[model samples]
Target chain A: MATLTELTPKLAPMEPVPFVVRSIRDELSDTFTLELDPPDGVFEFLPGQFTMLYVFGIGEVPISVSGDPAQPSTLVQTIRGVGAVTYALRQVRPGDVVGVRGPFGTEWPLAEADGHDIVFVAGGIGLAPLRPAIYSVLANRQRYGKVVLLYGARSPSDMLFTQELLEWGGRYDVDVLITVDNADRQWRGAVGVVTKLVRRAPFDPHDTVAMVCGPEVMMRFSAQELEGRGVPQHRIHLSMERNMKCGIGLCGHCQFGGRFVCWQGPVFSYDELAPLLLVKEV
Target chain B: MPETLVLDRSGLASILSELRARDYLLVGPTIQQEAIGYGPIDSLDDLPQGWTNVQSPGASHLERRDDERLFGYVVGPHSWKKYLMPNEVVIWRGERTDTGFETVPPEPAPAYALFGVRPCEVAAIAVQDAVFMPTDRVYRERREAAFIVAVNCTQAGANCFCTSMGTGPAVGEDAVFDIAFTEVDRNGTLAYLVEAGSDDGAAVLQTVVGAEPASDADLAMLESVLQEAAASVTKTMDTDGIHDLMLANLRNGYWEDVGGRCLACTNCTMVCPTCFCNTVEDTMTLDGTTAERTRKWDSCFSIDFSYIHGGPLRMTPEARYRQWLTHKLATWFDQYGTSGCVGCGRCITWCPVGIDLTAEVAALRRVDARQGLSVPLPEVMA
Candidate 1:
């Protein structure tokens, strides 16, 4: 038998600090993005990581950081008014305080994909979560090869980060392909599922790392399409979504098979998640 | 034989007095509404003496024993979790300040003396520790201050399978406990063979009167009694490759069969000492000023357990059952270094429809023999 060792007492698990909302911009009728100022002029987080946004007496919801990693003074998150908590977040005014507990979960693997071409597949509001990764790649553009972003939405109006997409489109280094399921009268871009653009998208599949974020069905098919084009399954990454009640793994709501989506991943390689994704209604 | 103390029935009363004088809240089993339930007790007379619980799948009742042996019952609906983790607790409380909402420091956990904790329950507490410790200070504070007194089972219940789970009959060598006792019931006369696993436990016993050091004969008698208890457990869960067996057969139709009978009532999880799944909810006053973030025990059996923005991932009742079962038997080993189930059989005896997981596993193995099981692709892909 060995002598027992003493461990330091664990701090309180759930601690929410107040962050003042600097601005709120409506991306669509039901969606909005919030810019918050932390007490200290810094709140650092990896790309693809999320925070538990608490709206005072309302509730909390897991929202990913859509801001640039370089900017620590301002914490940014995009959310849809799908539930009570999110709706309360949308109603918050600038200067109003909201609670935040995070910078949790696995981040996008930009370092692993440094020298390889990066292909981003984003659908509707899913683009918000992938925006930070896009910013990171663009900032270190010289380290990476060809960069392509294929974004899809229900309609042209449902698209998020439209202004940012236009700027990325103008860039000579990045190829931004936009698609809508249903075209409006003024729309002129590709009108189909994002997976359709996977065919015409110019990137070397053998030397490319694909980052996908979207509804489950879209991600499954996008990864399938990427795999068909010779991109290794392990190189294709996805940001998973489950009921993440607690950003910590203590709440069992975010379990996707053996993995806790809040902890082990919101980002997992296609190869690692292939078997789990295959299991129906799990 | 290790140094042990022999405490007759009178000594048991003295032990209770000593614990009370130490200001420790004694939580032990007592007769409650025709069933033995864990509650606060002061004296030996408060124990469910001369009473035994007859537990089967979805059934349990109190029956008077011929001998007045304390700790006669196997287990009941109430587990020690009610005291430690609790059913509902306000982990965080906040009030609206002029700046914003600020959290109020929570009150400290109560000091508890868990009296007559079964060996299987001792294992269950250890399982929960692996699940909650190092991260959840809310549950840790309660667990760290609590003292456990484990009692060995002299007889196994009808639903008992702790022997098969390797967590029972006699407490496992690695099981956590402060003190352990094996009751020797000889024709209605009761004597406890007590041994301290901690210095604090020994110090407490040192103060009790009429405590005599045990002899070699008493130690041998204790060993045979434990052996008898193990042999009596007819119900067994064969754990050979259970992890892979469960994870591989996610679409087993046996789940559909169990789903038909299981009411999704959440009784099993409530009784399961190791089922630590919970959900946090926020409650505010009518004025919408002060708010509390409360953590409540939740069951995977519920339809809303896996709900996201769109809907619940597991809409089908059979899918929920599969999630609960697979998570318990297979993924638990992956999450914690040990199996989630201590095999106390509380889940079996307390289940509304008697959905025995041991039998469910047997059914899955039986059905799997046919091969070519249908594991349909995701609804969208299909």
Candidate 2:
């Protein structure tokens, strides 16, 4: 076995990277995004992959890369201040130093998505992990046939990357749809559950890869919706997240059924997690 | 290559004293709070002398024998895993400074030797080797530096079935014990048929025992005692088709029935020699300038163990029970190439409500027989 000293992370030294937080957009009363500079290196990541951003004295949190993979490392993380680690991350300033650990976990079914239409559905801060796919399709322009982005949130204010959503709708190559559970006055968009938009998506079931990431209920509902649409269970992908510390399989905290989410996958097909899905709470 | 040596009772004492004088933190079995626990000892007197543990259906206690010997028990609650995998380990600490945050790595402890480890316990260590000390960087450092003295078991506990598990009764060829000893009664005088499995073990034996030779009869008696002990085992588990039986029962109602009574205290996993699930946490000092990263033993019984973004994946005790059992019995073959349970019986003995795994497996087998159907689960996709 290789020594621990030899396997320590050396690709990127444990030094702080400088990033100017351009803005703190409040997607919801509790959920927000700290849009910062592209790191020194090209921060490339596939959809469903995440990065471990270290806040000084506050420890690291695994937040998904919420920007386009084609662009040079402009990191955007949507987070909820649920625990101490995240609460500390939420307090960072416009100019702060944060260390990074990943691009970890199996990214969205990229090879499996070839020659297939893509449908992306996200809920609340769950959009953070799937936004990369939305960007990938927009950047590629002609690689995919049809692309659909369906996102749902608690309210209109909870919608993330709204400006990008509007721009995506204007694109000739992609279709963008947003839904919210409740809306106050001045809100103009779909006002229902995201599953309702599944019927309106433009794509063939056999040639589509439906990606869903959100609250477990929303993801489950979206999976059922896609299954109803005749998307083979193996072709539909879902990005899963858990409370993790090591972001490596060593921690053993994020195992789904018998598979380690950090090692075997963070992105898995419905056919794979289906057995566990039926067993309740999974 | 193996080196042979003989250490009489007096010579064995000299070696123990030598190890103690060197401050190697000699850990062995001793009666602690009425239960035989493995802990640091200063001299040979602290060993489990004539008293050996008698483990039964639901209880374990020490029993006195007429003769005096260092290792007379099959196994106690203390396995080598406790020290190697540790209940709590500090990975590193980060402190906030004006310049930035600086992280300090945890210090590794001095080298130590575990003496009088039973053959089954040695087998348990080898199982842990597949985990922590695997072809990974995680536990390589700790395992490579540790030392073990394997002691042959001459008697099987009432709950012991390691012979059926293909693990023990005596140390096998591939076991990584530095030195192994098989106790033998030579001409009514007690002596150990010692063999050094490593150069370090041979050097220590040469310095202490100072014996040039031992007869083949002494070694044969050692083998005979181990064979008798293996033959005397009263408990057994047919692990051959056990994995298939468990995999078939994924949706079996027995899981829910038993899980309803489970408290989710994870006592079974905590006492299990092979359950190595853990969780990591980060904490900051009151001043908020310093933080420490620590990994602590965790169990599958907790709701947070399989938590996704919004909530736990396995919330019900029934679902959690199914996960734990299937992982230990069925999927473990896929992960580690063997059943996770070593038949140490610690889980059966230490469970608060006395959830016996042997009984559970037997019940499942009965269910399989009554149904007259085999379980058919799809091949697990990688």
Candidate 3:
């Protein structure tokens, strides 16, 4: 393994190093995935961490890592062009040089749930942040128990990594269920909220560990449904989203209550966050 | 070993000159726009002497005192953060190159000698130290290089509550300082009791002429003055179980009541010494060739502070107020294992509506106690 110093020598936490866009793949109409190659070394990060992507003349925004962690040199980030910075990032072509800082924040608790049944839940473009975790689980398939993935999107065209999802579902050991809010004429999958699929998914609620990522409201309801199925609050983990300006936690835009989501978590268990989440507008 | 000495009022000039000779920019409280604020102090003439501050909720003014005392007034709107962390700092500037872009990190800060630092301010700096010292390169370098000349407060303002917070009125033994001084009125003559906390402080004092070793009587006078100052504090806070109290009453109506009156102008947060929230911005040159990323002080009161893709987490004024208070008194204990507030009372004095945190806490406790007593027991349990 290359040391951090060798990866980006003499770089400050806030400093952004140059990375060239190797390729850009359109995931959805609004979202695209970028594969980047650093000037010096690979950007090594764990599953469920994010990077602060900077466009040359525009600004910087936090985008989650959406690639396999094993290949640390290949920097991959999936972005939805919602804001100004992201919009500029979406227009980038291959060979364009952009500044990249981090691969920061808390990682998914994949290793901690070694023997336990794993349930991965995602909503809309939220699946982008969970792709790395899914890859980690698939690579180390024998280390865990039953693995289930439930994904929900707005429409058929909105589904990300469609080919990979199908391949994962084809595996005899995995269960993949995809849902859409509103289905088109050709759609054949279930059409309802993602949480509804939880009732039919085969897993022992007591023994399973669930990781959820999506909109705030969706995550809240999903957590509720998981709890209703007898899953302990601590066993249900969810990734939180906040305006992250400084990925190092100093900028303070990502504070959720007392915890800086940039540092302490973007992934937190339901038990640790229940009290703060219960309070309105925390 | 800590050594004590006596320096008459006339000796302050020599101290300033010594620090100036050492290439340290001297900063102290000075008369500025009817208030005593921290600014560049070239000599003793700039220090706010014979002028004490009168502070109440939402208001503060400088008035003439009967006797001459350099450090009589408590803290003003300005804090050490303006010097250390700064309001605006360019973290790095990037220039476009043929390959990509070359970035330049910010320059290191100059050495500073902060004169007239009170004990509470020291505690505030320490709280910020725990925060920025670990992660912030700029703050750590500037704070580590600072030469602190702490002044033990002999007078407490109307809003002062450092005693309740156990942070001030006197520089405690455990407090970190280069030099600590307590102004004593002996037979109506102003004399400063000086103590060296570090070896550098002792070396500086060695250069002073006609300085006498403090006798037991002088030490006795200093003790009585500090005790009187501590007893004179008008505001108090019950910090026991304050974290739990705030958490339990997060949804209480008191927040709504206070929020209704709060303009969310962010005065309290801006004036607070420990509120370290900030935001970053990128500014490009006219030609768009070079860009600089600057970090500025930010307040949680603003709706944009917590903004995400959908909307801001805190939309209402009440929620922002709760966030500020809860983080200061409660969640901060959970985050850093110490209260964020150093009890400097700047928030109370600088607040547009004069919102007193101590009063708010007291009110919440009263309401919480009342609610607990009013709850009826279950018939089966009874």
Q: Please give the DockQ score of every candidate, comma-separated.
A: 0.57, 0.34, 0.43
Where model 2 places Cα greater than 4 Å from the true spot, the runs are: A1-23, A35-44, A53-60, A183-188, B17-23, B134-138, B212-214, B307-310, B369-382
Q: Best by TM-score, which number?
A: 1
Off by over 4 Å in 3: A1-12, B369-382
Q: Lowest summed lDDT over 10 consecutive residues: which window, candidate 3 chain A? A: A1-10
**iRMSD (Å), candidate 3:** 8.6
Any residue pairs clashing in model 1, and if so which? Answer: none
RMSD of candidate 3 to the truth, in angstroms, is 4.7
- lDDT on C-alpha atoms for all candidate structures: 0.87, 0.73, 0.85
TM-score of chain B of 1: 0.95
Candidate 1 error regions (>4 Å): A1-12, B186-188, B369-382
Every candidate's fraction of true contacts kept comes to: 0.56, 0.32, 0.56
Query: By DockQ, is 1 or 2 better?
Result: 1
Candidate 3 chain B has its poorest 10 consecutive residues by lDDT at: B373-382
Candidate 1 vs candidate 3: the TM-score winner is 1
The CAPRI-style docking tier of model 1 reads medium
Error of 3 at B244 (Å): 0.6
* Tens digits of lDDT, candidate 2, A120-213: 8888777888887777766665777788888888788777777877888888777888889999897888899998889888888888988899
Tell me the alpha-carbon RMSD of every candidate.
Answer: 2.0, 4.2, 4.7
